[model samples]
Target chain A: MSSFAPVLHSEWLKIRSVRSQCLALAAVLVSTTAFSVLMCATLSAEDTSEAGFDPVRASFFGLNFGQIAAICFGSLAVAGEYRNGAVLVSLTAVPRRGLFYTAKLTVVGLLALAVGLLTSATCFVLGQAALGDLGVGIGEPGALRSVVGCGVYLALITLFAAGLAAVLRSAPAVMGFLIPFLLMLSFVLGDVSEGGGWVDFLPDRAGQQILLQNPDGPLNPWTGTGVLVLWVAAALWVGGRRLMRRDA
Target chain B: MTSIDVTQLTKEYGGRRAVDGLTFTVRPGKVTGFLGPNGAGKSTTMRLVLGLDRPTSGTATIGGRPYAEIDEPLRHVGALLDAQAAVGSRTGRDHLRILAATARIPARRVDDVLEQAGIASAADRRIKTYSLGMRQRLGIAAALLGDPEVVMLDEPSNGLDPEGIIWIRRHVRQLAAEGRAVLVSSHLMSETASFADHLVVLGKGRLLADTGMREFIEEWTTPRVRLRTTDDVRLSAVLAEKGFHPVADDDGRWTVEGARVEDIGPLTAEAGIPILELAGEEPSLEHAYLALTAGEAEYTAPRPTAAVQEV
Candidate 1:
């Protein structure tokens, strides 16, 4: 078996070598921060004090747009392998399919996490500044958890899309399915169903709960993130099995 | 010297056998030419050997272990199955760097292979901009990066120009001279004849011939005598009476199969058949390959009318 470290290094090189992947990473930071600050600046003090308004969630509004770039980063990193048959070269070099898959996800997950944390923290600070007197402090109740959880959420969603990309083996297909399911289908399903019920358990919906200061659903922030983790685990498992059983 | 040994390997896709009970060994210090028409399972066999695809039955091993079982398999065996199998957006140098990092190969080796492959000037360019010939050279550079004991290249000459072709022929020979086992597949019999010491011929996913290059041509092709006679009809009749089947060329020359020049010359002289020219024709590798794979080709184009009479 090949050692894990060198494989990790190689996977890292693969991700950074491509211009689109790097740009996607930058997009995650820029789009999320820019949109979050914009939302904070436009909101009035009247809305911040409202009982139903979640200031933390409002501050992280850019995540809605930023996650799309995160999805692109994850999917392109894996799906690019299938684009020109690079997977064949990859598998031949490693030969151990499990190790290769793990290393790849590890690199992608870590990179996304690093960028996610930076973006999350930056968006929070800037967004609060834009909100002026209405803004909440980082030390306030649930404020710290929301910020950290927001980063973890982005990382999880990135891995979630990457795992699906592995199974789908096409960038367009993965993006086509994931973008609608996260952006529209989950919302549509939530609106149609009363009391949230099982609809609250959807990966993106549950995961986004980590960004909310006051939880409306039955699940807490950590547990909501747990639901997304379960979804990610399932995707990665199926993707790994397919990679092993199928010929490159 | 490590060698590749395949035993009764078989691979079937959707109940159709792509490689059927194939067996061959590539020994060190020789270039083995893998010859077959398209869809003859050459690529499939190479894939199985490299562990890119699983064989349905039997085994393909390098240095006494399966490819996956060997730690750092690239250090033991290097293979290039497809030249175009790369991310087009990555520069050629970055592409090789990724592989080198995987195998723990030194970084300098990437530059070394780039220079060796004659693509160093274009090493930093995206592969999408590369010509097919340049891509082929990049592929070869990657295969040699490990400097393994065994090297397998499939259709290495596919997109090469005449100079590239000549360069690869010499490079392949040099690899064999260095005592490494090399297996190169090509449908061009002429190209194979130029570099390969041994031949492994496949037809419709079955092993048709596996022998030394000279022995293969000698065994599959028959000797023939070509003669231009002043009296073509009389010479044809005399050859027919002697139990020799003669074919007449459009050039008015007569060819007799399985006949020696020594025997034909004296026989026609004694029979008083006036012959303007008589000589023995050396059997070509193309003829031998065509004869061996005559009916086994899955795809064949119809012969043109103008060329039919030359046979």
Candidate 2:
């Protein structure tokens, strides 16, 4: 068996090379930070109660958009190889298909986690700076939980998309498959009364409960993150099977 | 030992047999040219050998071991089944770098292959910018990067210019000389005839010939004897007396088999036939190929007009 270093190195190289990945990463960083700053400016410009101007939720508001960018990047990290026919050479070199897929997921997954944590932390600090003595930061009740949850949420979204790509192997198709379910279906429908309880269990909707700014929500921050993590884990487990058994 | 042994290797998809019962052995220190027309299951066979596709019936083994069981199989068996089958957005060097990294080859070695393939200048360029010949060379470079004992390439000569063709021929011959097993596929026999020491010919999904180049040229190639004379009547009488059957083709050149040109000229002259043309058409590998796969050949080349003569 080949050492994991080179495999990881190759995977990292792939993540860094593509223009789309860079663009996606830039979108994640800039959008999250900018959105956090914008929310702070809005809060500071107007006089609002602590509940209405929760610094944690204000800073991490862009985690929603950040996750979308991360998911797109993560999905393409694996699927782009197939799109360009490099997967054949990749498989030819590694031979152990499952190991290859796992190595790729690990490197990209870790990178996503690092970026996710950094983005969330940076947004929290900057949002506090813009708070202008108005709202508390991570030191406040639920603020720390929200900040950490947002980071984990970003990483989970990326992993989930990466795993889905491993099975779909088509970036466009995976995006199409994920958009309605992750971005709209649950969140939009969950706002209504009848479907609210049921839609809250959907992956993205359940995942939002991790922010914890909504103290009266059905699930705690950890439980919401746990539900989303389970879904991501399932995607990876199934993707691993197809990666190993299916022809490259 | 045979570097590649494909025994009854069959690939079926939804009850359609893309390849069936393909059995052939590729040995070391020789170039085995795999010849087949398009859709003849050539690529499918190569994929099966690489274990990219599961065989429906039999197995494709390298040195008695399956491809999946071999760790870093590229080190033992390097393959280039498609020339432009690489990431288009990646630089040629980066492409090589990734493969080297995956196979655990040294980082510095990527430059060596770039130089070897005559693509050093283009190494930094994206594959999308490369010409067809450049991509083929890149593919060859990647195959040779492992310095493997066996190298398998499908239609490596495709889209190569004349000079590039000669370059590939020399490279394959050199690789074989270094004791590596070389398998190359092309639809044209003449393209690989001079380069391949042995051939594993395929038509449709079946093996047509598996032998050395020299033997295929000799055994199956038909030798044609041409004769001419001024005394056509006298020569005709002699031929009739000897029970020889002669039919003049378009150019009035009598194509007769089973006799040498020298023997025919003397025999016709002795019978008072004034000979104008006497030549024997030595069989080319092209002819042998035609004869071998006549039933399966999708395209039959017409005889050259010069080869047919007048009395």
**Chain B alone: TM-score in each candidate?**
0.84, 0.85
DockQ metric for all predictions: 0.75, 0.65
Q: For candidate 2, lDDT tens digit of each residue in A39-136?
A: 77776355456446556677777766777788787888878877757788888887778778878988878888788888988898898788777757
> For model 1, what is the alpha-carbon lDDT of residue B35?
92
lDDT for residue B69 in candidate 1, whole number 0-100? 84
For model 1, residues B1-311, the per-residue Cα lDDT tens digits are 88889999999999999999999999999999999989999999999998999999989999888898878767778788889999999999999999998889999999999999899999999999999999999999999989989999999988988999998999999999999999999999889999999999888688898999999989888999999988888898889999999999999888899998987998999999888999998888899998877755434435676588876
Error of 1 at B127 (Å): 0.8
Where is model 1 chain A poorest over a 10-residue stretch in terms of lDDT? Answer: A44-53
Docking class of 2: medium
Which residues of candidate 1, in runs, are more than 4 Å off? Answer: B225-256, B259-279, B295-311
Q: Which ten residues in a row have the lowest lDDT in candidate 1 chain B?
A: B294-303
